[model samples]
Target: MNTPTSTHCLDWSSKPSFKPRILALAIATAFASELMAAQDSTTADKTNVQDDLVIYGGTYRNTATKTALSAEETPQGYSVIDQEELTMRNADSVATALRYSTGVNTELRGGAVTRLDLFTIRGFINYQNSYDGLQLLFNDWNLQPQIDAKALEQVEVFKGPTSTLYGSMPPGGMVNLISKKPQQDATHSIELATGSHSKKEASFDSTGQIGDSDVSYRVIGLAREQDSQADTAGDKRTLIAPSIDWQVSDKTLINFNLYYQDDPEMGIYSTLPAAGMFRDNPNGRFDQNSFSGDKNWNAYEREVTLLGYKVNHQFNDNWTLLHNARYMDATAYQENTYTSYLDTDMRTLHRRAYLTNETSETITIDNQLSGVIQTGAIEHNLLLGMDYQKLTSDIRYEDNAIAALDLFKRNNSLVDRNTLDMTDTIYSSDFTKKFEQTGVYLQDQMKIDQLVLIAGVRYDDYKGSESGKKYGVSTDTELTEEHVSGRIGALYQLDSGFAPFVSYAESYQPETGVTRNNEEFEPSTGKQWEAGVKYSAQDGRLSGSLVAYQITKDNVPTRDPNGSPYDLIQAGEVESKGIELELNAQISNNLMLSAFYSRQDVEVTKDNNGLQGKTPVWTPEQTLSIWANYDIYTGTLAGTTLGYGIRHIGKAQMDAMNTDTVPSATLMDLSVGYDLAGLSTAASGASVRLSVNNLFDKESYSCYDSNNCWFGAERTVEASLKYDF
Candidate 1:
């Protein structure tokens, strides 16, 4: 037996270089001087330096521009899902909340793997997420952090290559989870819910000021338990979040937040053999609710803790300083048993088991200086910022062969956990990894009458090293990367409430491994071109956007035919082009509507393995969703609300060869709610709601890949009671 040792490190190669640092400083100094010189020429009125929409009665701010700009004026495409909509849909997870959003594939791994929000954006996997305005650094491990929807104020989705404002990210897009902060007024609410699969949950939210001081506090807590869709598995979770706000002066404010979550049991991440799930089998069809793992040998547990703070200081009416930071520690462990393949009989499935232990620690910080200025009738919102992020993680994996299962005989007793071997094998190993990135960026949003112009640039540097034993082999890899990303866009607004916009953006993501020739892999880079038109009703009751985009990514990694199974080479490129449309409207005094549609085409333009021109797996060609809500205000059914929704996903390729496909599916959802106050003034602050998802039980496969098929979620019914004061 051989003992394995592993270590990884990431650091700056040498002393800080002066060229980039000087350049960044010079740009900021120039902007500051121009703004100050024009200050005396113009009044300090905010409307002269910035755009205002308060008169419209509704304003939507976004992070797409690194400043407070309404979505209609941001030039790029994005979406916002507020808390009221979340309640009406009864969304329990991030993916569920985004199910009706455009350009997102939210059911990739289906319902059993709710532990992580696995999804695709614009045909590419988007694994990075942000909290507030800062990123939650994560690695390519199984230790991802999850934030409960109950503690969030809203969810924001920004599409296309977004590295100009954010340091590094996927070409497709990114998601930002906005936490519920302390409000000026006091409020309190408590809710109890029961749902399908014996699900039970309780939660509460309380916020108010600290006596008469200039301080406020808010606390949120939740507890839930439920049986998993798969047998022999279950889900349990506990979450608590506390926050405080302090207004030291009229020009300065600070906020502190703490989040903690524990999941004693996360449902199994298992898949069924495609032979029975998709193809014909003599033993008949596989049950979507069947368990593929042993009850005594399956488990997944995780715990996460995060602490963060935000500060804002106004140095006058023209300039402000903003800073934010966060620290995170998370750990996860999973033991799973899954099928490998079907036997010749098409009924006996070969099985295997694996165990994984992962832990990670991360720190991120961002600082920015924003200024509003006017220069000869041209107003500008300028931002200059810098950010740093570091992540350290350790992961260990072990595999073992398990007894086969005969689907027709229904004999699970043949497998005995105590009799299995636990010795080291060729597939067992441990690895340690560390990564760090530093970036500086500048952006300016300029407006001259009805014309808005926005341009931004960013520079990022990354360094890392990994030394470990993987697959019974010693490995050492080192990587260093530097990239400059940028974005430019222009939008023109007309008095008729129509805006036309066009933009170009670029992104680069660092790859962390070596190629077959022992050379480090190059970073994958992407470029996108987009054009769109947005319509906003002057009354602020209706808004819509239609956009078309084309994106190309190079340096994609693919299997190396001449090397071992684990070897890879950066010799592939992919292209994705799509159109997206979204609308939100208050059709009448009591009726509201939301709808989204997306159509895309993805292809491997270049590859070493005869995969060129083939469509990628898990990427559907089209998707559509629509939701509507109605309320009765003056009738026997007064205080009653009704909601209806429909979703559809087109067929998608199941393999790189495009030899098989996952059929299309359509699902419907319904909800009803009533205020108890109608019964008596004594229940003035109480209400009840019932929601049903997948009303028809739509039985189908969500996705199929790597010789496995995932079953879609079944029909679910949930009811909740709430009280507020």
Candidate 2:
């Protein structure tokens, strides 16, 4: 087994904490008592499977069960962030949109890597995303596609394993982004904004029926540019989304969509040595805004285009058929120089430059048939689904050793591309990978009075092939695997709006490529056991949930102990157990609140390395967020709105051996908005908003692995002006 050098560091332990558990149990008990007393009250009608809108403040239909299920009915953890919430927070990216969600670790790379979505959920990395229930094209390389927040209607978060409906995924769960479709009602808006770091942006959205025809159209576009914290680095983006919805007949409807995004400059996305960011150095700490790369050589360019359509057909009042499909083409080119290692003096550093050009093409399709039937007192909602996905990616890259630098000196060793010699640089890799998967699934939801039971099973066949040279080695590899996933859950809804639920689910992820002996890699499998209780007020004013879950993943690939550097063996296992609490409330006609708390304990249960029983990097033990907004309804300041939020990220281990630590950090945010219509008769549909993140500008580190460390985002301010017509 390969053993990493152990260093003297923090004594942070991975044991589960009991204080939060006790508090959650006590709160649940108190709520149960109060709810039981109101059991005599009236109850709500059963959920309609076709309802795609939100129910009970925060709910969705197609996220967890592929059918309509309210927050209090679904046997899993779920959260939805609507357009209103997004606007209130001025969220521009998916990571920022999910900043306060439960069981999610956003901005693990701090504010860098804006061109990609890189974060953790339930102690596992989950960069894959779904758009309108279809998976986006993502590969192991740098070709990440970023979806604009202005084009989304809502973002839904599903926590825990969901492989029964979705084909292949991690046990941590999935994120689904709902797009903004065409509407019959005419709506037009334009927005302009400017913020710190010379940021500038403009956006527009228009939707309406086309000349009173059966078809409606929507067009959304945005342009943005901003300077980064890293010296001589900046970002520029352009995006456009167009869609059309047609009512073919009383029983059939179709929607077509096209999305295009381009990023000409995505800024430098690299890390600094831990010696200056987390640990003490002889030369003192490094600046958070330090740049370790040559500005003239750093480059990041990307483009993504996707076209898709959705169809819904109703055969009768009890049966419906739905189909969705999308094709995506994405490309990225990157050049970056990063720190390799710090010298013994802790002031001199070695660097390496890497360059890559990659392109990926992906096609995904999903078909589902849903029906409702009743036998005696039992009601059944059945769903039969089939989904297919194919992805082909081509990548070429080169790596070269770069000149060293003095950590405390200023621009003493900058590389000039015009004068530098590239004779020593070598092309390192050129490869192509193709993957295909087909999944067939069946699910049944049965309801008998207050009890709801859900059961589902899915079978997936997946294959992968790779060819070409890898670091000077020529090879051709193929791997094919098949697996069956299942899920079962039970929930009992009481008349008082209190529901208790329990569920079990299984998931599998195929590993690409082959081992040293030319053996096909085995797929990793995960299983989870989850239980939770949810409550919704009868008045629809409040909703809350408390959940506990444990997930185990096996067949994980680890480095082969006795083989060469690039060898691997599938003999590792990991376990994650956690508890989460969430609440959303409309306190009054003019006030709203949202909050969540999560704590997790993760460990490497089995591994060939000496990392067994240790916590992984970037996995924090606890996270908490609270946000509130207030609107003045009847006063001199009646047109004003105020918002405040607090977020806390707990300590985390820096290495697989559990040595070194990244200290906890707490940040504050503030926002203000006003309706300009109240100021003058001519400004009827105008409004303005201002928001500041990290209000105190607290300096902190997001993560510090043994090699690299990341600094969290500094304070940022954004102001926007919008007009509606």
Candidate 3:
């Protein structure tokens, strides 16, 4: 890892520069335009039509006749959340922004600082986060929502198995956050916002040329403080980030970025009382004192730093080399306390304190050679590349007191210290985990008449180790697996307005853990096959896709010791089949809509414990979401917009035993906003938005963990004033 001081140095004097030249023939042409036009008797074209739109960092684009095709077109499913959508919703966290995305589940624990928010995509959990295509690895699951949404250009979710690119990941998917980069021209903005729940925030962003040179840079910073609707837990955060780009002699470009974040804490709430417990005693409240001793002391503290550098060089036009490096350090400390109320006067006191410190360093160098070759009546775009990644996770745990206690409501406090036995010593343990992966891939795109064909293949190798506090007691293992993961697809354009395509692809994930005999286990594998149809307008104002897929996982680990939950052995298989429909369109000049629906059937195909035919826990059978926005009128209400949305989650099983379930529920949200001048001081050129969430105040329970139920948000009104410059 590079030290902070070494990463900040500038070597501007050692770089080259590019110069532009003008031709005399161009000047002469301008002078003879009128004469030449009259002689030719031809009119110049006036329509503004763009045939290609580059996505910059990625091979995909929005302008391709078919969907954008990269060097390699894998069969995995992915979604992108752009900046415009983020701004419209004022997304504060990744969970909040991706709540409606298909094949994703977000779990929010009670409290501000101690929130246990988990993100699972396609049933895979990716604990590692990435920024601008670089991985951010930390041992603990402590993630800060302080990441400024305004500083991101887009959020990409890659579904299915993805170990080929990101080494150690759950079967789910990955979330990549692309940060804003410097543009060609100067752009600056200062945004101030204030809303309900005592929310206060400020953010600033600026990007422009560096001095009088062609180089450019961008800086973004944000700070926020807010109180929550929960009992006593709120949140406070601060973030600072900056990035730079240097166009050294055109062929060589350098980009660098640095960021830091700080968050104090949040709170958590206990589960809802059991059915009988709540019905027998209507006013009997589940002990909410599970966090730290004091209501105000249940807090979480964290600090994170991310530094990355990218160097791209062009060797002629057909071949280019890209080298990227990133380093991250993150640490967190959290305290949680909750009480189990057996009755009004009897309860069990529990408190947990967690601390984690982790660091990750990675470097990847890929060389791609792309060229067109003609053979008889066919043409091909061929590409070849090699990639590598190394990831390591160091985790430590401390469990102080796991004792039970009785509580007698003394002064309204949930716990009675006189009846509880406490311990002063802390028990600690440490584990260091490391993973390494490398792959080589090749792809080609063949064009024949009106049909476009795409194909690719990749070979990968992975290895890792898990070490303990006592170094010699560690275990090491290697994963030597080769599989063909690629896509075979063809696009046939029926006309300019309609086109249909079909594709087949494969994906895989590596498993991590030791077997019953203390030997490392083999990696579990998954495969998926999908077919889809898509439609889009030539003007790019509307687009939609309907897809159907079947995915299966083999070598699933099952519990070996009869009823032992900790002993896992490979004795089961699982499969999932689903269909999804999505639409994004601008119906009119002032109206827009985005909607999605998914129906899934997932089951444990075979298991030793008679779990076959059981639905997967937390996997809802169906989900639907829609959002619509419309501008009211012109003139004084020209910028006035009204937005409404609804989300529905189908009933799902809550336990592996399949004996308990959580009912399906629907939620609604409404918002109105207007942009007008001089409504009040500090309000000129500003916009005011009013929103009501959970509008009907429906007490819906999304999930329950062992009788600890979680309820959806309550009816709440929030108003915000935003000023942009």
Candidate 4:
């Protein structure tokens, strides 16, 4: 076992010379702009400032980028879900809010039992989720928390490999959650909601300036408890987040935030036998709400605390500096029993119970300097950034055999969850994993009148170590890796609000697997080439993008079933080619529309065991979603609004071997809202809305293979009442 030695630790600590050089370069670059600013006394800036609605209603412009290029000018595939859209859909989790995103798929691992949000972007699974442009870590092996979307101003999905700006990520893409910031004008809202499955929820949010002291505060809190559609399963959550902004001086500002979460006691559901679901069955399909696992016996509890801060300073009108950091501590314990596999008879199911405990801590910091300058006839938007991320985790996994159940005679009360004891559980494995990554990136978005050129490059250093007792044997290993990634693109704008662009991006993802020859597998690399056209109405009421792209990943790791366990092969390659179209428009004073269409073909281009040319699991060939809302403008129904949404998912294969395929599914959602003030003067600031999901009660399922499957959501009706003061 090659454990990370003390010498390696020394090597990790020996890379600080780059920092001072970067700082010095940033300073020199900012000074280089002095003559340009002095030369051009009058330059009409077509850019948005800090306080502007960088993300105004359905606007493609975003402040999250460290540069001045909006979505249209960035020359990459992107999607944004504003607060108004999420609120209208009544989205509760990050996954729910992003289901309509092009080429995206979300999964709930253990069904209603473990309602954590997991996702696959494009054709690859990703674990990198960002909050307020910073990393958010909530992982316990396969278990992760479902981020609350209620406190977010918007969610941005960057398609393709984004490692040039964001550090070490899955080849697919990333999700960026933008937190709601403190506002200058007073804003406050209180809401109460209830829905099917005996759900009850309440939330409060308020933001405004503080007593004219050049300070502002925003606080958001929510509590919810609900019964799961799965039998005997229930989940509860409580969260509080308080943030503050202090304008220390005219050119500098400080921001701080604290978040606390107490989420415990959620069930984790896996699945039933394929005999009843996919293949010929001795018995019929199990009851949709039947209890396969004892909800009380299975416990998934978690708690998390996060502290973060940011500082921004403007040295001059052309340059600004920003520093942001965050630290998180998360702990969780889980014990659950799931069907191990199907029995020979196919009518009875066997079970296995597992117990695990996890504790993880992470720290991330990013420092950036962004500026705008001009040289002759060219305008440059430049950003330089350095980031560091570190994480350490400890986990314990154990297993035990559990009694089986007769599929034909299933009832919640049949299993006495209270009598189950963990005392007899056998310890199986314990391990600790630690990871560190540091990156320095720079991007320049240059504009020459109607033409914009975007380019970026990044260098990354990574090290990972794992130590544990496996199979009653002690083992430890370490891997050190480094790589460079970049993106380049150009966008040409026409006089009629149309933009045509072409872009290329690449990524490097390190792996821990070693080959039979004891040689570590090389990092997987991803490359993409894309071309698109964008349109933005001058009034900012309409935006759209039509993009065509091709992406390929190489050096993917795989195991040959016909070979030894240690025979790991790195000769795997996969490719995804797709087209995406997105549109958001406010056609008239009362009508709003949002729609998207994505068609993808993901296949293994190179592999062993006849796996070549096969479709991987969870890659849907087509996905389409559309939503429209219209508000009554006058007369008797002046205060009323109606909304309708439709979603379609194309067929998908179950595994790399293509043994089975899950059929496509479609769903519909409806919403209605009315302002109470129009009905009576006493309720001036009160309003009510009702939303129904899966309006037709469709039976949809997501399958990973023949043995593993997930049932989709059932019909649900929820109503919310809100008051603004």
Candidate 5:
């Protein structure tokens, strides 16, 4: 066995202006002679489309060919949102970036300082988050995009009951964030942006070699402050992240990452009843004082560290082995207020602080052997591998109280006293919890003629423990479960540009709560089957895909009459079927367009609460997104670009009864930018961009659960500047 050394970084910065200038002059000199032909706009359109640049699949390579081929590919639906799309959309936070993604929902709470966003994928809610393939240990809401969009290479969304590979989670997808690694060569850039809602932000990123021996490092930092269109609410955030990569030897590489973030509590702006009814009030005003008392004082502080090591060795040209291992630790604290119709006039002050510690390490050893067996008639690529992962998490919580008046009218100018009421009204619970999980997987890939096939299977074991007080009584419980999951699929390419594929996969999620009768429920299992067709141009410039999928989950836990509020064991069975279509093409060198459309039917097939026919609360039936950008110049004026986009979300039911619902809504945005050369004191290239959001000033709701609801932002405008050297 031998290890592989670090490879040089990839670069994409190149510009040639002379050729465009010469072509421009020639066209201008022949303008009169070609006037008659030019008069026909159709002729110009044909010429322009031929000159456009097509980005078939953006910058990331599709190397998961083996994983994507299977009769049952572990039956899960996953999607990758790349850096190019994130940058083009100017997403400021993780929640905003995933807004239009299929089967994903976001919930925003509190003011800027105490803002909490949650994502539910395919009827599953995820409170635990991960970064760089490692779990981020925090229970309270944490904003991720604050870390700097420029620092992330891509965000992978793995959907439909994925606890077999992970340890514990809601019945949703997992979002794996991939961070930018240190580049072999030096590169630097700076960005300054000002946008609607009085928002201002500045960020910088740089990478280069650290020392003489093949050691490289990268650092990214960002600071942002914005006032909300709503009164008395906004957010301010600061983040710093740095990473280093060292090539210890030909077959060994080590990487380290450190990150820190600070955010203060801001006021919470929420909708209020027109006069007395919660759901009946449609055009209700935002109760700026909804969280007035001590609850209004919310804030979050977080820190995380990650260390990783990778080793690869080529036993020979026909066989190889690869291994990767990582460790991570993180923590966070938050406080807010809650109010109910029972005490509508008085806010019930509640304080919550959660601390989590997690560590995970994975090792995979794979051998790939290939040879031509029957001359040009038979070829094989065989793969054999073993995979292992161990993860543990410890969580603690604290609850406190403040006077109703103090919670409804909090003053951020000063810190309020920590008054302890010790009375029956004051409630507090302390808990220390731990969870462990392990998984081993094996996979194989084979090719014959023009057909490709892939297969894989994994076995997972999970255990959890909770030790704390329940209703003033000491409580301790332990739970365990195991599952075997796998996937298989095949792909066939036709002579033209068409390729059809089919796959089947199985997934599992660990159960977190017991049944009303005190019996621990087994892990929930999900099975998925899918088929799709893809088309692409010969040059790989234009491509499109149409896919249909169905998923079913069984063995869900039911609610307990005496269960805690946080206990979310499944109540019954759920089934979902959906279709998605995506298209990407470069109409011309100066113009490009991308679009996606999805429709899903999610229902609870079996439940204890008579909720079988109800629609999932946050699962929108339809979602659509489109974006197009055009460059105004080809050479010296090439920096000018104009862009516009729109997102539409279909109506969604809010409650199990399905009587109350949030209607479908559409939002539009526009942007324009110009690049200036040799005008910056610190760099040679500078650009300024202006954007308008919700151009129609639509007043609509973005999300609503039974107990809480959020309104989308109104009309807002912002401008930004960037300098590169």
Candidate 6:
């Protein structure tokens, strides 16, 4: 592990020198008088998997890089969860799809009750998820809206800071979900599924040319309803999305997309006391699926809608332009009885009732210009882009204390809402807030024979304002901030199919409080230095990477270790050093495997909160995961297949103090299915698969604090039947 000082001194902002010769050539090519002259070599060379599907390791356009590069050709370390992987695992959520991917820990906080995609990348939690490379937003800002897994073509995860391409994000990493687009080839599919907890689901997808007039369209929809592992907990959801692509002219193309979702049965995710989960409790331990809240008064519902559009234009073979715009709205309403306290005896827990409503609206726009040119002895791939986002939210709430409950004598009966003390319920707050951010970036990838160099820079301006009534008093607050971030990397290709790479990156995120000197605190900043080796096979059967990095974050906001909540400081620092190994291989004629391992040491070097050297909760030091699937090619079971997967998470301390520990556990999963390849024409492409998760029914717990502890998943079984045309 490199010292923290090394990361900050790497001078990641350094830029490479390029020539105006290529710029002059690019301009000449763009202004060529030939209107319909043949297409250039650079036209439509977009690294899109949808354009050319990949069954094994293949090409990809990392939105993070803004340039299409093969896995081994890129300097940054990343992971890709493709469609084949999604199908083999029968994953239905974004978190589940990336469960085996490295640098990710999807604990599924609150489990089936809340159904929020809760996870951490590296050692930090960030909400910078993107849909088709654009930020995803919800009208209801309190909860994350889970995207239907089927709607995604792939999920790309880039580890470490990426503020150079994007803007204002956590230092750990980000997840970018690529949405399925309209396909030129005609295709249609339908699937039906049933599983434990009376789970029932149906999905339909269709894509093809409307009339062969240079236009394509696609539509996808699904409906799902399922009970939970816990008593009286379940959820129902419906989703529909449609998209269209049109080549209006030889030089211009446009695409549009729309998505909507509704949830009628959202429940409060369940939680328990850390004492009852990690250590011996004065009272008896509660069962893993115990329901500790009022069942009747817990009412929750949410809805989301999104619309987006993209335009691409080619001025000539060497120059291209792209513009994308999106709008999203989300709303949520809830009235619930929630757990509020665990008494000194650890046997008594308090409850509370609340009614809340929230709504959020967001609009984003992104534009980029790309050009290909050659200067002297080097070829340059250049990209210049700009993005702007505006978000607004409204929140309202009222709450009151509710009756207490004793764990020893459990009550399964629902609590009547009318019985609560309504007098104690008063308006907590009603407010509206608006935020806006704009960013501009420039990047270039230049190649000189076996050596590839990448450099990029970005600038961002952010502003926010809040206004509303609090306790019948008008309140208002406004903030403005700006930041500059950058990155540089170099890669060398070897004759032995090995590539060595080194890179440095930086990022910044705004803080919310003022320093002790009465001036606003400076934004938190992060810097990282990484080196690694990448591998790819000429036969396209294997691809993998081994990467090591040291990252440090400064100006972290800390509560006055000895003062009140209003008293805060920002002179804190933390560092993380780790190595990650991942690989995907088509090992044999009938077998495939994917594996990953990660080891990291994250610590707070300086802090005012008395956690100077403590490791935060939920971040394990080591993790290992493997998944393998095999097909039968001979005998009567020729069309049958089997798959297995396992993941092990090391011990995680319950809190920063390390007083309690969450024991390590290994989880297992199994899947079996039969392909109808030799069946009659009508059923030729039909298939059925059965999946059993948590094969051993192992039990475990996870927590980030003493107040919020989560129980791991239990046994689950599901079967799916699908027909294709």
Judged by TM-score, which candidate is best? 1
Residue pairs of candidate 4 with colliding backbone atoms: 110-269, 113-267, 113-268, 114-267, 114-268
lDDT of 2 by residue, 369-464 (tens): 778889999989899888878888887767667788777884733777766543334446677777887788999989999999999999997777
Q: What is the TM-score of each candidate against the true structure?
A: 0.91, 0.90, 0.79, 0.89, 0.78, 0.89
CA lDDT, every prediction?
Answer: 0.77, 0.77, 0.54, 0.72, 0.52, 0.71
lDDT of 6 by residue, 35-118 (tens): 224323342432222222122111123665765655566788788888877888888888778779887878535355544565
What digit string (tens of lDDT, one per residue) describes model 5 on residues 219-270? Answer: 8888888765444566677777787765443322345566656554333433
Report the lDDT tens digits of candidate 1 across residue range 453-490.
99999999876666577667676676778899999999
* TM-score for predicted model 1 compared with the true structure: 0.91
Better of 5 and 6 by TM-score: 6
Worst 10 residues of 4 by lDDT: 1-10
Q: Model 1 off-target regions past 4 Å? A: 1-61, 410-415, 558-567, 704-706
How do the candidates rank by TM-score, highest first? 1, 2, 4, 6, 3, 5
Report the Cα lDDT for residue 25, model 4: 41
Clashes of 5: 42
Where model 4 places Cα greater than 4 Å from the true spot, the runs are 1-64, 108-114, 138-140, 143-145, 411-427, 513-519, 557-571
Winner on TM-score (1 vs 2)? 1
Judged by whole-model lDDT over C-alpha atoms, candidate 3 comes out at: 0.54
For model 4, how does the per-residue alpha-carbon lDDT over 16-116 read when each residue is reduced to its tens digit? 11122344345434543432232322223312224322342111124335654567777888888888789888788887787677868775332353455
Candidate 3 local lDDT, 360-475, one digit each (tens): 33333333334456788776766554545554555444433334333223222333344433232233435555655555667676777656676766676655555564111344
